[model samples]
Target: MSPSQTLEDESHPSITAVNRRIQRLSLHLTPLPPFQPSPQLHMLECAKAANKLEVDKASLQCYMRGKNRELQEKVINFFESRPDLQTPVGIPMEEHRELCMRQIVALVRDAKIRPFRYVVDDPAKYFAITEAVGSIDVSLGIKVGVQFSLWGGSVLNLGTKKHRDKYFDGIDNVDYPGCFAMTELHHGSNVQGLQTTATFDPITDEFIIDTPNDGAIKWWIGNAAVHGKFATVFAKLILPTHDSKKVSDMGVHAFIVPIRHLKTHQTLPGIEIQDCGHKIGLNGVDNGALRFRSVRIPRDNLLNRFGDVSRDGKYTSSLPTINKRFAAMLGELVGGRVGLAYSSVGFLKISVTIAVRYSLLRQQFGPPQQPEVSILDYQSQQHKLMPMLASTYAFHFAAQYLVEKYSEMKKTHDEQLVADVHALSAGLKSYITSYTAKSLSTCREACGGHGYAAVNRFGSLRNDHDIFQTFEGDNTVLLQQVAADLLKQYKDKFQGGTLSVTWNYLRESMNTYLSQPNPITARWESTDHLRDPKFQLDAFRYRTSRLLQSVAARLRKHSKTLGSFGAWNRCLNHLLTLAESHIESVILARFIEAVQNCPDASSQAALKLVCDLYALDRIWNDIGTYRNVDYVAPNKAKAIHKLTEYLCFQVRNIAGELIDAFDIPESITRAPIAMQSEAYSQYTHHVGFQ
Candidate 1:
């Protein structure tokens, strides 16, 4: 549901029905939590669908607002018929993406999920949700897991019926969500305090899953309440006849427990669920809580990689340490974080689309003869939006680049390099989302009060996408991960202030820079960067490296005097800043590299502007970095004000052209608040009526 629908419009019975349908919606938002970021399309669908269906609030359960029985059926049937993709193979990711675009477009056209957007709430059962959120789960979970697994995850071939059939039986064809409920209300980061226990009964040959206390309740599980058919519940396995009635070194096990009955829409005995109350954003999702009272399962329910129980209900495992087993379980969630980063790129594209379109059309004062120029003509607007535009472009390329690298690493099983890639991606993901939260809001505000007007898309986008900042592994946590990686590099070079590797890197860097940035000539093959490629390359690399080194050094110094936890917390801010430095450096590398690769001159010119916009944007933010590198003297940053003005002028000329690349359908994009074309057309129509 969206704020646009006039809840006050109850004169008609239909409008009254619509308002009630929305009142039932309950969920939450992010940005302040340890979740993850997501795609732009999710936000766009909400805005467009709210306009299309004419609803109230940002409710994901649009089925609640169906006007007629037929419309409701259309909405429900659309999802019911969709296929589930268990393993993503043979299908091209691009094809999968196109399918999502077409599916949503068709969903809107057919009035399926008529209110729309709410359909994105569940990721397990349907293909689109699977493609979007499930894909992230895999991307992020796999990425993080790969890292965590190396530190500890069990080797289980995933997404295959072979392994799934063993553990995920009986619940087949249920066509609903499954959850991994590991977080207990009493213990978030601490795994030991989880009070849920599974006691073995040798006579019955069953393991009972029960939440012993209120503190043991599973909280914050996505799609848990209404959507989930089964859950992989984590509980301590209590073995009898043997010793301590208390916790053991190797008792926790992941069980495939069925919580909902098939014939009736009632909860099975011993299972309790509650929908989480309203949230700050992500209102479409049915985040929930669950409690188990004497819930029992067969011996096979335990995922036996680390620990298992026999048919006689005897506990048995060769697992070395419970710590390793616990690490393995937690390792499985790393892909979620990676996917959050990737999704952040997708959302960035939406911001760019809106900002660029508005920039092109929302003009004023720049051309007095024109009376009103597009807001993009103003340097302030460009400063606020264009760099972000460049950032989205940067992220788009970076995402593709990393995906390709990830795929390769997976193929080659190059563990060492993959770790570096994971670190880089983690840093990149953390950095991008942190900035994206700010950038998206800035772009939203650049639209003036129209930005706040829900009709224009920003407010809802802001509300729904709130989790990007701190989700999928907290931004701070991931930044520390990056800091840890950087500190390793710093320590490796401990004696290397001695300079052998430094000169080797500096020489290779020079060679690549010189080769990439050939002389800036009018020759057809000679690109602008070719003119003085080294200077441009050095501008990004030297400054970023300098900043990263400085922060890492500061952080490294405290380790000697302070306790580990204290130092980690003390250097938290430094880690975050260094994450930004990596982002700046990576984006710079991506932008300069991509611009040079474009074959067409016009394409090259447009791309070059994006690159410069990115560089200048960062330079403006940390002028000190540039100052330190001598890329610009202290006063030169002020002089570079001319560049922003000039770029704004240039960007204005190209804004319309660039935004067209997003390819948002005119059917969806026809509103004036978006492009102003709709309002203009309305004015024309009113004049005709007069």
Candidate 2:
């Protein structure tokens, strides 16, 4: 054969086979199926799921509203009726401040909602009105809080009857807008370290208030920028000894200082007031920095509840030491933390409601040739929002319990009760506000691009709530306070000292969990086992107990080397976890109690479902801790994860009714996407697309 003919005949068999296979595959290939047309089901499935259960929204609303429903309704209605009180979408900072002031003025003058009158007599009623206003407009809520809760509360709680008689009516009527000046530029969490000085002048019977330096300037004094005429200023009390040259420091005390002219609203002499200017949120609050230069006030201006100063420059207090007196003073002011925790639930309710409602209405991808399903139907979306929805309910009950305890504390003035309420308020305030601050962004993202629009309220809500974590007390520092109390109680438990109701769990958990040997075969993975309230509570209680024991040991072990402060710093993260675990247990306990106390079966069932989700979700999130300690076996942990998703689905079915139980008015929610009907149309109108 010729060379060319032999080459063609001897071609690679692999290449020939690949070419043949390609041709065969090409011959078998066909065009893809045509894209299916979108179906038009008119959201019937969403409506069906929304109305799946007999949620009894009214009964649930009444239950969630807690006490003073009539008063809360009145406050909500008053603002809802007034169009001017409705926060506009876009406005200048000065205008927003003016609007917030006007809203508060109307609330006091026109609506006649006087929280000051009920501050002591009916604290639940007081909190109801403040919380309601907060749900309406956060700026107005905070302005109301500053004027009534902080400034007015300081007078009522820290001062004697004479102070109330002088300032109560003025504050209630907005005749004298006031600021609570406790936080200095450099001293926010440490009131004991405040640099401002109030030196007694026995000859004049006056207190000369002086800011020692710029760091001593009172910063973030709400209402001081323009509206406030007076301030409840906290400063160190100094008493002059017999010798003209010697002065004694008497710790911190509150004094009423005039910051501005009451009639002309001019900055008072010796008081330099500068506006904090525009802020990320709460521009409506007129926050200002105040510098006092030897400002003189009558000796009577001293809020003499915890301590008193004689005209002869002598200091007297029933509490023996400065620390005890300070503790008592701060205990009385615990209402601020209580109110923050309470109002945070309101903000969470609004944000969750908006996110849930929008999720129900917003449809995305679905199976071909079928109507697009609501985002809420997607497990991913449900995971993002359902847990938050569950937490809102959990925090609601916890806040209500705190309010009741605080009210009882005020009435009884029992030392133990006061201490319990103080610690409880701190933990809840820190936990709930921190959760809310983060959840607001989650809610914003859950709503997709629409949430970014200012009209949806998420941007403003997130910004306004951002300060909540730091203000009442910085969350980290507050959590440390809780852990310290825990450690104290833990030590006291061994000394035969009785534990308070809040810490009683420590005793039982230490006995039941720490003393018992670990059982290798206790991994119950059934749905009932996972959802059982008893099981959930035990898990929570166990985690807290173990953390308490371990952290205490860690601190003790490290103290020998690192010293006390260094050891504390080294164990700080563990302490925070311990505090948070304790708080979660408390929240779960409160939630279970609320569910058990519900009168309506349908509402009880609904709340129970949400409560289950809250508990399981918490456990699932911290499952690693449970597994590492062998508290939960792998199978049980898997069951918890599965049950959490199952509970989310169960809760998602009635997400609409659950949010409706919050009963946040459309006027308050103000987000067009949160509307019950024609949401798209309302959104279009809101965005000026019409």
Candidate 3:
């Protein structure tokens, strides 16, 4: 056969089968009790198809939707096609967990879910795939995330070629289930204080890994209870001394340790694993606690990309400082934070879709002798949900930007780039997850009693996503890290003499504005001035710069009396505010850039409205910050309020269209109210009070 014909012949069957399956699943996955398309939904779909109101599904979805639309659709279709993957309302915890793990394994076996495995063409695709699966089932998403991003990721990123040669293929195929053993019973975010120890032994040329105290036990380890055979363990490495003992000052390192016997599926010698019991949500993940008692692993088990110990007990590393080495090691896993943030966005999108659609269809109070109006028509409902809808878009584009940065850093491994990625990821992760948690909760409340039902999916989304704010580094701690980085940037501008564009671009760009007389003064006269993207950018930049300056001054003043830590503690509230503003500015800038690059005029126009709402709402929320800096007069503050309400009203009309642009599948939405139904009486009588 000719080359082209041969390629076509190879591709035809798989493509045809996928299409056939999707076609078949669509019929099966349609809402039960039957649903009729609402007029608004019909118009939304028509507009999307015509590109008159497209929202760049690739950007929103964070996958190569253009190139991988088939894969994306197939993944969604596969889940909708499988009832086994769906959790029963009140099943036994163990049974629920078993099914969850099984479903996760099924996804791992699917070709569409394979993009989440390591070494994909694009890192964003990894995040995109996880988010898509998560939108349907939070349990499966967490289970797969634990297996792939956390466990497989630690091995792939931290371990050497020898480790990869032995483990990657098995991990990729799930022949060996693994857990990331980082958080301890006593220490979660404070990795440096973890009590687990790996002591080097010259005589045996091995590392003795131990959880000496109860506090040292690995806690919240997904896959460790019953499925995992191995773990990438993080422990303080104790260097062997000539005085017949090992000391722990050497620093922390990651090691490959066997936790369970593969053939028997039981705890290995010197290891004990116990289930973490049940949780409010994501119980399907089988989170477990692991304790090690002098487990022996070979010297080569150390993942020594940044540091290593010789057989003779000498410690060596290319990086001089423990902090630098630690930063580099953790930076390799920032992908986890990025993934969590995007997954939270998925939850946000799903929640808002259910809430808004329900609001439009389910009506409540209205005038006497008048038809009951949709709850969405009420301004209160708009205030509660519209801004959240805007934020979902902001996070979508911001996540894409972070994914692009992560992909670039993975290729280059530049030190400055790594630092910037760590800082930005830390900030964005905290911002996205924190906002998503609040947004999800708001969505639930907006939907009234019906949202509390397990079937609605919002309750589970809220419960499952709650962990996001606490894990992958606590949001509060991560925000502090962002503040610290900003403080460093402020110092670097004077001390280092040169700065990278990522952290320092604002510094350079603001010089012109900072030098002008009354640079932040907002003229409240014209709509063109108020809504101009440039004006919005300037307002945000001014707010962030002023906050940073004020915090720096406070810190410096306090440091004279208190120690550095005490000084920082004294000004922490201000510092946190500065960090929050800085993160908001970063998101706004990235969202604007994405909007500018959009090729379609209609999409741009619609997206610009969402983008404007995001910016204005943030500014309106921080009016006190603007007032403190004299950036806006009282009249301008009122103008900001009026503009925000007006923007929300404009965006509200296209809210359904915007949700459609997210391309959420009805099967995943899992809420009947979100789907259109001609039997309004039936819905009002039955599902209304659930």
Candidate 4:
């Protein structure tokens, strides 16, 4: 049945069940997570809870199972309400995140407080923020806010109110920091290629912005095609066809253009608009194109913060390099990567929360008479869920680092830092969203076929997150950029410092691995390390760091002899693999930190288990750093199996709170598979909503 139909079928029953639940909470339905001790711990804690509460083991087990069912049902109900908002993939994940985020924010505006209950009841806020429905990715817009407020918004605008400025008044519609026009169809990733000419018509003392060809039209601009009424358009400054040569009129420039005639949504005369066509994802944004044909604007409309044209039509700029001017314009895109990186975190949240919760409630194996075993009990399930959990934690750590870098760069206003952050962000952005897309799919699969049901949420998240891998820049392409940056830094190491020492050490390690007796890119096995936390951590740390250095070295060495394009291609070939390994290595490092920092005994044990899983799981990826080595072949199968078992064990311990992070309230997730138990009283019921 459609989700709408499904919800209708269960709505009445759910209301009754909810009412019973409220009454039971007044009595003994189920205790809260933090207070219940074994509330989220499935087996061991539950066994203890039975002893402490003097309750029957069977009854407590039944209660625990039923409450989990209720929570899962809450999640299902959340999806049923937002039917039009199917999670799309490709570039769509970014928009979906944005769309869900905004709606969630809108819900908070009037709430007495930003209640957790609201996110479950109306999740559009979370979902909206994913960047669907619109072509413009709010990720950049968000950074714009971040830079502006440092309070909330990144360099992107935090839509405070409508602005009816001289050139554009309609920009006031959307909330927050905003974006300007820089990307033209011809310009693409190369902004210096822009051909639009914005010339000062001396008599009128107004700038005439014109697109000379279809190729010169601005395309793929997030806010430009819609929502954004005011755009800082880039055009070449040209002296009249009079006394000066092209050089005399030379230099690309930026101007503020009022593209739309606000009230009517009509393009100003000489401005033509068209949708960039249907896209793979990020549909909520009207990713459209804009063209100008002698569009007239007042002389002051030129964005002259860096350069200016006088009323008499004379041109002047404080900076000398036209190349630098071009760089400045493209430089604005720096925040794009930062916002995208943050966005990946939110997408990971929605995905893991759904997968973990569903994993707990949908138990399939057990005796015919006994309660079914939670799917999480199986080893394979842990292999799927735990690594992803570790991944979410890993990226969160990296994202925090990126955010801090962004903060420092914001304060320092260092141009080189901006570019560096930009490159790193681009690389990190690609790594994260792509990995999230991969991991979310894995999460979907780990839950068995039930993961495909729309009501289950995985299929939705998987599809929705599909676009994240390719949107901002194609994942492989972005990674190639990262690889290039790595090579550049490698070359710059002659200046030597502590980091130089590390890099040199890394170079030697890669050389050692490549010099292995047999290095044929064999798969890795972690059998011996499966039970040994230190071994697993050390092995992963050593191998991953080695692989990254090797990949970076190959690109750098090739550049000196080959032409630039060939050099880039040489690096590009290894980039995707390098990015994957880099992300995994980074994740492992953070996982180790979590293990070391865990204050509680159980928590430390739990983190150690996660570390083992993370390390052992990617064994082969680690060993690939070693050249084709036949020596490690005999133990491969054994290691894979042991790692698999470890994964299962870890899942058994932490499946409950994993589900809680989905933030789905007990009041919601009511589909059939998500049902609670039948053990409850007339005063208190158990069973998923269905």
Looking at model 2, residue 591 earns an lDDT score of: 98
**After superposing candidate 3, which stretches have Cα over 4 Å from the reference?**
1-69, 110-112, 119-121, 245-248, 512-521, 678-690
Q: Give the TM-score comparing model 4 with the true structure, all chains together.
A: 0.67
Give per-residue CA lDDT, model 1, range 202-304, as digits (tens). Answer: 7888888888889999987654655556677777777776555543435566776777875675788999999775666553344579999888887766667
lDDT of 3 by residue, 597-637 (tens): 77766677888888989998998998886765556666677
Location of the lowest summed lDDT over 10 successive residues in candidate 4? 151-160
lDDT of 3 at 256: 88
Query: TM-score per candidate, in order?
Result: 0.68, 0.92, 0.88, 0.67
lDDT of 4 by residue, 1-690 (tens): 222221222457667667756887876756655645443346544543342222133332232222233433333444445554333333353464456445333323422123222112322222222222111223432322321212112112211122223212112123322335566776655555678888777888988899898889887665544454556677888767565553355577766677666567566777777766555444444456888888888776665645677777777776688887656644544555665676676567656665666667667877688888877766567667777776665666566556556656666757667666666677678878877888877877876776666555555455545765655566776777665555555555444422322123344444454344332223344445345655454454455455566766675688789966776677665666665555555556655765575455554555455456556656644444332334344345356555555454644465454344334333233322443343123113222433
The stretch of ten residues in a row with the least summed lDDT in candidate 1 is 146-155
Question: What global local distance difference test value does model 2 have?
Answer: 0.89
After superposition of all CA atoms, the RMSD between model 3 and the true structure is 16.1
Task: Show model 1 residue runs off by greater than 4 Å.
Answer: 1-163, 166-174, 186-205, 235-241, 245-247, 251-253, 305-332, 366-370, 409-413, 492-540, 543-557, 628-632, 635-641, 667-671, 675-679, 682-690
Name the lDDT value of residue 45 in candidate 4. 40
**lDDT for 422 (candidate 2):** 88
- Candidate 3 achieves a global lDDT of 0.79
lDDT of predicted model 4: 0.53
In order of TM-score, best first, we have: 2, 3, 1, 4
The most accurate candidate by TM-score is 2
Alpha carbon lDDT at 112, candidate 1: 28
Better candidate number, 2 or 4, judged by TM-score: 2
